[model samples]
Target: METLEAADMTQLLMESHELSTMINQSREVSDYLSAKRQMEADVEAQRLLALFEKKKEQYEDVQRFGKYHPDYNHISKEVRELKRTIELLDSVQAFKRAEDSLDELLYQVSRTIANAVSGTIKVPSNNPFLEAQSSGCGTGGSCGCSVKKPS
Candidate 1:
């Protein structure tokens, strides 16, 4: 039985490796890698990214000490503006789209595998009641009570 289990594990590992290779060779992943390289080569983007990181560290340090500063808000806004500027670049946009596509694909694949293994897991859908419950309103006298039933 132990030998059989080991063999099964080995086979699973081999299949997983092949799947990873296929995903790496996919067009979305290739585009993402190319865009990442382009972004790395961009001087202005790097400068803005460095500034954002520095500001983020400062904001986090203030938060860690349980103190709020106007500078934190200012830094946050500046970081957001810098992010928007960086996102406007064609390479950055392409990278973001490609990354999102790959993320969505991976999510679906994991969900499918989990469903198969667990016999249709009760995953949440976009139902209003479920949404209300997930949004922390399941109590009888809470906002969930205001949700009208489907006629």
Candidate 2:
């Protein structure tokens, strides 16, 4: 029985790796990679991103001292403006959309795997919509909720 269980575990791991390979070859991953490459190759994007990071650091430092900081509002505005400018870049926009698409695909895969194990199993995701559903004590019996355990 132990040997059979071990064999099953090995098979499951192999199949999971195959699934991973398939995911890596997916259109979402391809688009993500292409967008990332384009974003990296964009000289303007790189320059703006660097500037954005510098402004963000300044903003963080000012934020640490709260409203009392002399340059708080100015630095904050600069950061926001830089973020807006970065977002407006075509390469940045494409990369962001591709990233979100890949994230959604991974989230769906995780949810499917978790659901196969148990409907109540929580599937973590960066999506705000999915997060709203998982907000409470996840119905997994371990949470000490009034929800009944799956049979």
Residue 133 CA displacement from its true place in model 2, Å? 4.5
> lDDT tens digits, residues 28-60, model 1?
788778878988888887887888788778767
TM-score of each: 0.66, 0.83
- lDDT measured at residue 3 in model 2 versus the true structure, 0 to 100: 50
- Report the CA-based lDDT of candidate 1 relative to the real structure: 0.65
Q: Which stretches of candidate 2 lie over 4 Å from their true place?
A: 1-7, 133-136, 139-151
What does each candidate score in C-alpha RMSD? 7.3, 4.2
Worst 10 residues of 2 by lDDT: 142-151
Candidate 2 residues 1-151, lDDT tens each? 3553345888889999999999999999999999999999999999999998888889989999988999998998888888899999999999999999999999888877776767666667788777455444655367666422333
Query: Which number leads on lDDT?
Result: 2
